[model samples]
Target: MKNMKKLIIYISFSLMAVVLFSGCKKSDFSENYYNPEKAVTADVPSLYAGLFKNETILPRYWNLYTFQVPVLGTYTQIAGYTNGSGVYEQPNNYTGDRWNDFYKNVMARYREIEKHYNALTSADDKEGYKLFLETAQVFVYDQATQIVDMWGDIPFSTAGGLNAEGKIILPGYDNGESLYNTALTELKRISDYLATVTPNNFYLSQLKSTDYVNSGDLLKWRKYTNSVLLRLAMRISYKDEAKAKSIVQGLLANPTQYPLAEDVLDKITIQPNSPTSSLAPADQKEIWNGFDVIPYPGAKMVNEIMVPTNDPRLPVYFTTNKNGVYNGVANTLTEAQVAEGATNFIFSRWDSTTFTYNHLLPGILVTPAEVNLLKAEAFERWGGGSAKDAYEKGIRLSIAFWYGINNISDRVEDKVEPPTEAAIMAYLAKPLVAYGTDNLNKIATQKWINFTIMQAQIAWSEIRRTKLPVLSFPNDPTSVAAPNPPTRLLYPSAERTLNTANYNAVKDKDNTTTKLFWDVR
Candidate 1:
């Protein structure tokens, strides 16, 4: 077993070297080959570059179309494409390489970054070294938590690193509960580390430039860290209400140390390298043109909810069809029915003129609207501020964000005008929109709408957590999978073959029907 594991690791490293070094110039190859030690140690910039690649979120063509768009989008009821041949018509048929993507690609890079940072000598700038480590920790928490959310038990504690160092070749799985606890501890450590740095330091300036997400703005990173902390806390609220409330109250109490994203400008976004970068999801000429992930607003999101509530940002969210009306197809449609291309059922695609389709639009990591909605829920459950204020703020921020994405053209025939303030106010005045003591449903539903195409994974996570704006199951009686939506993704086949012992231990528990640790529902 050990010999086989060593062989696998050797092959994996050789393949990785080819992938990493194939595109390098002659000069680049010489520099790396002659100065091997320097090459390993001087990799902080490359580490940051690897982290900012945006592949984990955007992914390749197969993962995007098959897994992310049709599977997750349909499950969350954000968007629905043609369910041709019932491949994505049910949860059981759904599968993804999310496990391998995180473990082999994302987490492996993070571990390498950590190893390089740790090897730094005492002569190295201590503050600079600390900044890199702390920043990496924050990202590790973000990525790892998402993995745990998707799959209940994961190889967290002993997953990444080169096998020669005695790191587990077949690491055992850790349950979600223990992983969440460790994540909270790590988040607190990062928060504490950030608290030590004073304003106008040289180390601080260097740290800022290394950050691709927030551009070294420590305040923004601090807020982002707190926001993630809040999200994790909320995730385990059902099982560990006391711990959740304590973290929430502590963060709320110390706004100076831990600020929240109060406005859309403060929201965390990853800027694209250029107009034709993969980071831009809407850049049709570049990446998006290759895939069918172009989202149509879901019917439940449009006709049943947004239309009934007279949601102010409808125009900004969806384009108008040839008839100048917003319409969405049902997810339950048969493959034959979808292929027929019925005109009345055919819905509008995303607007090309808006930032949604702009090649340069920054990839949103987390939004103020989402944080505000989370705040509203936290406040309702455990007092920190007025739930009503947070709820209203969340709605207004979401509307304002979409409005900021495009210019207001008064061409009434175009069916794409920014809603007037009066229109927004009137929409909010509706009994359903107005906040009440029992308004968790309202908050969750509005958050779902705000997520749309921007944060589909998060929308799915929230749906699993709250089950708000209850979506209907696919009505196709011929569907092969379960009647209800899947609560989690199945473990990837690699785990079954490569790490059979650990995989078998949890295989029975790993399925679409199984709820994650935090998903009490």
Candidate 2:
């Protein structure tokens, strides 16, 4: 009887053990179970949006456009230029609020990506995020380069990098040369990565839009990247022509790469409407909240030089005021004129100006028109391709794009005589208007005109390089308080407070008048 009882106990114990093991095995393979498989993926699309289109970027751009006291704000205030030249100071100084906004806020976004990109695990899932981040980085590099050129020895690579604890801090200065080289290397890396990844393959889907270039096509991304390579190369043309030419030639040789954005699809204009956005968010109190503030001396200069002639972009770019005038304040005006509150806004319905900021303005990036004009200048200066052809194409395309009156225009048919090919050629071939020094001047002048109200920075940059579209410095006592447009901006105040050592290391090397590494002259 005892033996039989012991056998029963052993059988029961064996049955219970089998049940427990089977249950454990099933649970191990269950779908609901948590697994330590992979890390979260990062992507380009998310990174681009976060870094580039962040609210800060728009505001910085706004600051540059707004304080155009001579042109934008009716000659509101006065400031000094570098040498105290008799010419009125231009609002475009290195230490102005715009520069600080860009340096402190805009460039920081790129630094964030540089610190975090490598740590992102499941990188395969993050391709979109990565792409957008890279794109944003490119723009940051471009913006920084602009600032550095204007001021000299700027806070660059290390400007927004992390500290010992991996905490993100404000702008830290780096050598200008180092910043340029690092940015170039980063862009190259991005091009290589995008070559292998497709848009759908990325972790984020946001940046995969046809809005900027190729509708998020990875192949198109390669082209856009190559074009940017050409641009960076040209930026160093004076300092390093051989290297610049090499990059330019490489891009030109690679037909598979993007030659340039050729259509509206290729254009990167932002739609003006958003749920919460106003025509003039800066002027919340005004009735013409979204209307364009009319011509300042800046626009007047442009119109006087290019309007009612070969350039058709003027009418499309700016609408006339109610009394049938589009006037630019003379540069000699006092700050009070600029500060006047009741003046009708530039492009408002009340003023019969159809081109209000809310209604017609488009956010601009690189475009075929600008690229064509750039090539014309390059050819004219460097020698090789047909400068005249490139110039003509640039003018026509610029007008077409500006007017929304292209072959693809939903409203216009081929019925209108586009600037006749003969007329354009004749215009380019004319002695006073074309050929010799005038040719390059006309090209730059047109580019500046086309780029109004959108990417004035590009126009300013070209002026620095070519010295075309000759500017009569603002003469208003209040506008150019010191003398002339300042060469560079003062370093932001925070640098003294947060990173004194790093700031001083590069301080003597920079000033509003200090030229950058690329501005060899």
Candidate 3:
């Protein structure tokens, strides 16, 4: 209890500390954002490093325990939950945490970088810092995309611009589709600019030294930028198929111009490192949650799906039970049933080395599997290329991606070896695992299985869109909360308290049951 309190306190202070430079709230904009009083000025490299260090992409304590496990993870069945009261409720503080992290930790540092780029006088002068400016924009845009997907409309056009504007100003809520369009437009421009723009030796050396995410590789940034565009393009597909189809087809049509992270090795991940050292993915544990309770593999995900199909990622995703076999908790389990399973050690828990305790787990942004899966969907739907080829390649890459992650992190517990080519081929040939029968279900199911709890947010969003690997939830008749999972999260209560007028604009769409514009199925 004491340690839990300390963890909460540490997280509380950490959240407060980061926001000293953000204006997610109108009042915070005064002490937060850029106060000339605080002397927050720093070079582009320093500010870029600061932005890169945030653990939004990592499987860390706050994001996992506070947000994913309780909300998105349960909603998508990536993490196990029981039939209980308040099963699908989105807590105000938990949703607010993500909002705060983006505006303060992410956008605040980004705004500072923009401020530096904006200060430059000449076009040639701007050229020196252009790489930093544009690359950082890709990251911020990606995070913003996730935020908009979670909430309908957000303060985008003017969220953290107090540094740029140099005054206290309340930002307005921008339309979600409009925000998507803005990011898509700028992402393409940035990718095009990088394709031709060459940085001189001096600035190149500076970027190489200071750039935490891509190391001085403009090609990686270009791939990452286009990949983010692909994600957003696909996300809006059902609601706005015309725009989605054009972007998806165009990206796949020109591989050289719009290169994607199409191999397992090309995952955009940040490794763990110290503050004084280069930026890395911090391999920290989620302290507040019980290891025994939360990460248990879902009943259908393990027993009904992976076990039947012989998934290579099975061991990486979960450990065998005491009976020396894999099993997941049944969704309909009562408190007694859950207790019985736990007492008997019958349920497969998440693999410690690859997930829970692995110190080498890097923060993931984009992956080859994700890009290829998107390609598979695009080709399968629009028919510019071979869908089967893309689909098979995506499955192969997903298996290899987990192996790559495990191999990179030194095994503390027993290591899970990568499967052979023969095994992979056989798995793919299986009647249940094979492509073609219910192709959309196959695609969506594979994507969801590969995502696991590691990419909970994306897994949830994708599942909501595709409604694949269909699973059921038990009703909590005694509970006051909704019987089923929510379509979206409720906005944080703080938004109404601090940013009321702006919050009111979005309040009409604030109910958790209200679907986003793209959720049309």
Candidate 4:
């Protein structure tokens, strides 16, 4: 959240076999584990750093254009679109890429990192290498939660055998509820464990060089872990309110032991290194601007929700139409009616410099503003702190957070100056935005607005969970893919062929209409 802090991250991936490792060279590690295929020792630090090289986490072409825009973004009505035939449905290839990204890019690598660390023989070697596995698991659990949220059950507990152990083990789908229990339990242990582990001098330097996300900052890792735990806890609250209450209250009660990332400076994003470099990230310009397929800001997002609230982040999130008025596409229209509006270019599209055209834009995962809002909801529901105070602060921080993104706008022509504190206070005091009335509704709306299309998964998840900022989509009656909005993305067709046996076990729940466990209304 530090406005002026330099953000650095990395990416070096092989096309399946062609992978990149940035942390340590073979010479750096003592001979412990070897990958005979690579003709080198398994550099634990390098593998740990490499675990974050994923398009889904890092922001890239595949997830944004194919999966996010047509699938997740539409599911929540994050934007308004014509209820054209097949608009709601996407091909298996689009969703397949997301599944591929999670299992191959995230889960498989983390398992391999564990494989290497476990292979270290000496107690001291294992101690030295364990930090890599522990820290890398934080990244894994975060992405895994997102995957489970999207598809409900996935091949989690046993999915990564091919890459990790060099065996073709078709892993069974783990229950979504079970995944949450395991993630929360392990994440709490990691949160507590991060506080005590101090790397040795050599390993510290190795980490500093390789761990570009936080530059070996253990405090940041601790905060990220606890915040993630808080998020998952709240996500499962509806199903197990008492357990969620215990987890959330414990964090709020012991801020010292469980520090939440509640400031803009503490935001967790994949930093873009360079457009050409394969170190940290790839830019998202093409997906936002060049792609004519991305939908317009919805009537609900622009007119109903934001305009009523006088939300300051409006321009930050979208662009005005040709007439210079901020209007949005309506889902109440027929396919032809929506098409006519889109043809005229009268509705607002996503903003350019702050989003579409911003080449330097980082991939957002979690933010201080988001963390605070989550805390507000937790306190409101569970009574650990002043919900009003946290809610108001979350609004303030959200305004600041958007302005921060504005400041980093790739061009000055598109930049809008941050509103004054008075403006922020006034905006917060709006009847719709103020904290007292409709507290839960207000919190859910703010989260949806701030998240926008950039964090589409979170937006969709919250919409299903809260059913706030109430919306109605013009159902595409002729479409077979999604006659109504989908509750979840269907599993990839590849799963049916590649993991045939396991896919059959969960095939009954593969339809888009089947809700995840956490999605119980």
Scored by CA lDDT, what does every candidate get? 0.68, 0.49, 0.75, 0.74
Rank order (by lDDT, best first): 3, 4, 1, 2
TM-score of 4: 0.89
In terms of lDDT, model 4 sits at: 0.74
lDDT of 3 at 89: 70
Model 3 alpha-carbon drift over 4 Å, by segment: 1-41, 122-124, 163-165, 273-293
* Worst 10 contiguous positions by lDDT, candidate 4: 3-12
Model 4: per-residue Cα lDDT over 279-366, one tens digit each: 4234445546333466587787788878777788887878888888788777677777877787898888887767676666677878
- lDDT minimum window of 10 residues, candidate 3: 6-15
lDDT of 2: 0.49
Candidate 2 per-residue C-alpha lDDT over 1-521 given as tens digits, one digit per residue, 9 for 90 to 100: 01222122111110122223333443332211111111133333333444434222232233433443222222211111111234333444423445555543455435445545665677564554566666666566666666665555665654545569954444455566666666666766776666665555434345554123244555555655655665566777777788777666665555554345544445554433442432223442221332233333243443355444544444444344455554444454444554451255432121112222232233455666777777777788777678887777777677667545222222232223346567666655555456556677788777766665445555556666666667656533543344444444455554554557667777785444555567554
Q: Tell me, what's the RMSD of every candidate?
A: 5.7, 15.9, 4.4, 6.3
Give me the candidate number with maximum lDDT. Answer: 3
Which is the winner by TM-score between candidate 1 and candidate 3?
3
- Which scores better on TM-score, 3 or 4? 3
Clashing pairs in 1: 208-216
Which of candidates 2 and 3 reaches a greater lDDT?
Answer: 3
lDDT of 3: 0.75
How high is the lDDT of residue 325 in model 1? 78
Alpha-carbon TM-score of each model against the true structure: 0.85, 0.71, 0.90, 0.89
